[model samples]
Target: MAQDAKTLDLIAIGRSSVDLYGQQVGGRLEDMSSFAKYLGGSPTNTAAGGARLGLKTGLLTRVGADHMGRFIREQLEREGVNVAGVLSDPDRLTALVILGIRDRVNFPLIFYRENCADMALQPSDVDETWFAQAGAVLINGTHLSQPNVYETSLKAARAVKAAGGRVAFDIDYRPVLWGLTGKDAGENRFVENQDVTAKLQEVVALCDLIVGTEEEIHILGGTTDTIAALRAIRKGAPDALLVCKRGPDGCVAFPDAIPDTLDEGVSARGFKVEVFNVLGAGDAFMAGFLRGWLRNETVETCCEWGNACGAIVVSRHGCTPAMPTWVELEAFLSERERPFRLREDVELEHIHWASTRDRVYDELTVLAVDHRSQFLDLIAETGGDPERIPHFKTLALRAVRQVAGRDEARFGMLLDGRFGLDALAQAADHDYWIARPIELPKSRPLEFESSADVATELTEWPAGQVVKCLCFYHPDDEIALRERQERQLLRLFDACRKTRHELLLELILPAGMDSDSRTVARAIRRLYSLGIRPDWWKLEPLQDAVAWRETEMAINENDPLCRGVVLLGLSAPEAELLASFEVVAPFPIVKGFAVGRTIFYDVARDWLAGRIDDEAAVAALASKFKVLVDAWRRLRGAAEKAA
Candidate 1:
């Protein structure tokens, strides 16, 4: 009678723990400088991965009343995984695993799961009614190794089976967790034991699908021979889908069932990727497999999906956090470039992490004064002397604070390094999100910072800051010109990676090249093909909702993880700029606006002309900035109300 109003694609029951990975690569765990915490554990990762792949997934596990436990729950919920069945254990603490990447193949891990909250899962925690609310239920091998949790898993499996739900067993057999190996047993690929084999076989007999590595299968089948193992597994569960994961070679699936003498099975080749970490590949594979199986896809397609997911997870670090989204996977599949491009090893990682970071743009209003050359010329004209430009930087920063003026609105600014590093630092000190420009204007071809090589200059810049770089881009530009510009942008993208700075690529289609929103969208796609995935795209405002939609589709198709678009005010009048906001209002992809002259031009001119003092200029600039901010907010408010 375990039925709920809502049903899920898959419900996974077992271990959920926190993985604290050492950040310093190629170093021993003890020598690593820092650790990055991510939600981990086999069942938890599978649930999170399923949700990432667009499955309605849920987790049934127990975590301690601690910070790590809270983090695990929150992260699962954030990924759209239902955690209604994830219970809290007040007595025991959450399990923890510390992992270190010594090399592509060497990942040293230490599991601290002795008497953990997940192990404290009792039979009472099993909600039999919930079994009716899932198409499939998955129970891990490690969960069956422990008595209390084993009983809990058994009850859940029985209830699921009784409710006509398919049960999938993942042989997540960890030797160390089973107390069959020492702490130094770097990889627990297999552990041969009579008791363990019997227990696993008991559950394997009940599963509609059985997934494990060769070693796991050998143990479950109670033999070292692969054929013998297949026969034994088939004897236990003749209708179970048997999948044997063959590492980088991909996997083979006996879709209907394994036979006594299996000669062939549906197979898929794995994607070739430079492995960064190999910890979460299996769980990621299972997630993909489930997504395909539940959709009733061909066994070969399911294996292909599984391999693709594993490839992505291994190319990055950590477990649940490293699992790719549907959009990311599609992009990864469609684009096939060499594993290593110039500076790709470093840049791709940064791009992956930056794009995956949660970007919530709920009425974000950004003030951009990151103008250069032609835009700066007007500032010089207003100020009467180009030499007074440095002072304008200070004025701009002061005006930023004035505009925000104690309001708790999410505000951002795009400043340039030419005369604005100090202002950048100031804005950062006040904790305002700031973006600094790296592009030098009007060079023979799009030039980056001139003072030093791209890498050297970026190294000196402050860490954790957003960099803004512009290019005079047009899709129809001569091939040579386009290539040159793209090369320069790639260098800038690499520089951003080395500096650990987020990039906001400001793209301007030269005054007229049959330009429309579609042209701009094409330019964005072209950059993505060249592997320039920026954190934000600063685009000129399009005229209508249709154009905006086209541009958004391009961004999604090219770089699904792109940090959305922001309208750039090209020194337009305030009224005209506000009009642009109205046009962009219907498009959620246009997160906010980064308008320079519209907000600060008049105030700068009045102040430089000796009409208004510094204080008065600050007030006027703040007022103008606030006016635009209020206007943008009003549009957003109206849109929300309409929706």
Candidate 2:
């Protein structure tokens, strides 16, 4: 709040909530079993998106003194957004939204925000110092509809404008939030009341820029006609730049004068893309426009960036998490042959999430040694103490260090809690990523691991670590098997959600069904149909590029937010595994290889048999691991060039 060169570029004040989106497509909320969580609300999204675009943005709002409140603050900090103005209210609860994707057209949602923390923001909570530091102050229309928060928003806007800061208004009208009953609350766009119009016009006259859709313009201007409403808006905010968002038709901008014809004003063609969810498009457009407006760019360029950002968000899932960065926006704009439809390409999603992720992984080559009892049986012949099995995991950890020392690679190890908990704690500090296995081995019916329950184990692990679970599943037409498998998966999926840990599901086709591309693809789709969106798909190597592409398409089509697939080692020979890399290298979606037995099986066995020393086993495993990593890098380089 103090005077400093580190002042914010934009300060957005209004509603913030936890958006829980149903993963089941075309299903009613009552029947939904899985939901993806993200930071929601118009102003919150704009703050996060602007920060992602390299703007110094801050949010001035209130969240309840609970986990949700902490979540909002932590996410803002992680995205490099300033939260000095975000206060916590212990007297109320944070807002929550449960949204469903019934199709591309119908996204039914319910808001649970009665007496929420953000709505309870009093004038005393207003931080004028924060507003004074920003170049612009953004106000959401929803905030102006309330009495208490409305006064606070008005005070902040007046203070900022008086201090020579720009006041921008985003007409983010939500009928349900306004307690309107004349029409269907969720579908109401324009109510056209004299009192509402007068209140909005008062703020419109004090703003430098106004952004809204046709419906919002109708409400603010108190007219149903688009042209008349825009003219009315111009009369109030004579000098402010006006933006009219026309869904798929693109947006038109009025820098100074209102045009008689739609084509007369500066316009930018909208990026045509298949719409998955339209909830966050408007917020993304605002963030993109502000990026150019704050930099003093041409109206046409601003419109281009706005349209590009809107297109990217609508093609993906949630708002704040899916907003594209400047790098992604530029790359998407440069592509000449890219399809306009939201094809949900795994390769593209992988690149987008990895590039925008908080954790940096230049190149990942993970050594997965989460194998359980069957592995112990392999050492039974030597009459070795089964308790010494953990030493094998420690040997694999040494091998990870060996490869990491040679090249600057981001490595991860999938360790089992059965005997590798200490190994996990030790490996946690070496700049290595860790994924602990969660499923009990060799269970045809499938169950949680014997040692730790889902909740207990997750509570003990480090925050933000990955949890890997292996299941022997096949997509046969048996209803009982499918239902049983789905129930178990849902339980684990929900656990991961509550615990905030990432899930990597290693799916193996049972011994009977054909492991052909189509069969495997169907199995993957079936899992997704049940709303199982894993962070990564650990699969056995396919035969060729065509088959691998088919598998990639299946995973992408099911869940666009999925992180991507990682190759699994089914104990194939080193030569066979190397050949498989040549096939998958063409697909950028296959981020990196996560091989276990192929890299460590023989060396581990020799070490257990007393035939190899610790140093010898580590060197052997490291050498094999490097071969696969190098092969993957070569193929990935070629794929990137082709892309």
Candidate 3:
């Protein structure tokens, strides 16, 4: 029960569910055609939101032993939340909620939680030692509606309190969840019920902090008057900090006496923005408030953090995914003239997109075998069946596996869906960093391979696969040609943003364009000016250190959150590629190489011509790939040593 013994900042206990949000805004749920899935439930969102804000948080709940449960656990882990206590219950199914945004004020939702796994949470599921390590614990009011979950949450709260940790309560009052309304009325936030009021009051009495909106406070205080509700709650838990979330007007906090007016308490004004969905705003506010409160910040600062977080989430779509990261939160707060529409803020959106990505590759040594036309041409030259190209692509993947040995973080494959479908599936199964091509091979002015509807096409690709579009571009191209290419690129960039897929824009100078060191950098700047900020850039290796610096500076100045760059091999010989590596050794922006023809051209040709067996081809390809990797490492090491 020592302060030093507590390691985690917070542990959230209560509901966890998979939310299927109707994609069509301003449409009724019955007429909705498509849905986007996101993690949901009050405590789960709080845990993830807290973790995203740099808190060491944990979740204590039960999920069904199914794919959805695995998704919840994996997502929590991705958010940097400790899931040691997220147990899988084989007896029940995980909870689910189908939600739709009809408009700003009308959000229709249905919760299918009739004997769900989270409600099956038992006292036995609460681990005392694990609960004791947290500095604070948060339990939502929904968990108290059921006896089993109520006992489970109470036991965990007692464990944390016994360890000198604080307990916070979020009065997440849902009348449907408490069975006070029809099963279909999940959108109903409150229903006056004496039993619900008494139950919430019991939980509120055990808290160091209590947070709720006016309706929620009404349910807890058994009164509709805001000041009377505070007086009621203060009488029960006199020392607890009471935070009242007043939607657009921001939030207010009371540390001691119950004030006659809500404005008498410590208050912070919310941002002026259009509300998209008010589903997860309170959970975000709770996470933000904890970020400051756990750090012992002033009450005003806590209110500000909470208000900003709520404001940002209300203007976004889903709950858990809409939670802002610490960097995003700071950026939003640092703005002097805040945008009226937070969703339209380009820099904030970029920060959210970059920071919330599930994976980050510090360095990528990828095998660029995403060539379609080149493979067909090679097959034609060898008089071999084009059918063998897919198998050959599979062999290339095997070669990468042999060299990388499942080290997915450091190694990747740039494969095309046309010939490398099977290989792409296998690579994705092993969680490799994969990129697939969209642009037709060697198309001047760039045309998509399959369909002009790139957004629809991207939906078929796996979420992990980056949309790799190789554009034959030159900054000095004729105005018409340049504009056409830029339009296609802009379309592709917009598609990637919609599909939530990372894009790697590979820029190559068309066959006979005169170029200097500044050409590529200028091309990058032109794209940035057009607002085409791809997550990754694939460029030909620069000729000198000055060129590399220019490229780095261009990217850094335009978008620091750009995922850096990967060097592309344009069928260059191995010696030439190695020399280019030496030139790029000192620059940290060039992550690694995605060389194809140099490593695989000869081996692939020999294999296609039946001059070499599969094993021989794989061995040769792996050896060549390892040689380039080693050369990059050696040169990089030497540069480090010299510095």
lDDT against the true structure, per candidate, is: 0.80, 0.81, 0.91
Model 2: which residue pairs collide? 274-342
TM-score of 3: 0.98
For model 3, name the residue pairs that clash. none
Q: How accurate locally is residue 300 in candidate 3, as Cα lDDT from 0 to 100?
A: 93
Stretches off by above 4 angstroms in model 1 are 1-6, 23-31, 88-92, 103-105, 255-257, 260-262, 269-276, 328-364, 367-492, 495-502, 507-531, 539-563, 568-573, 582-589, 595-643
The candidate that wins on lDDT is: 3
Model 3, residue 440: displacement in angstroms?
1.0
Q: Which ten residues in a row have the lowest lDDT in candidate 1?
A: 340-349
Error of 2 at 374 (Å): 9.4
Poorest stretch of ten by lDDT in candidate 2: 181-190
Model 3, position 189: C-alpha lDDT score? 88
- 411, model 2: CA deviation in Å? 11
Residue 326 alpha-carbon offset, candidate 2, angstroms: 1.6
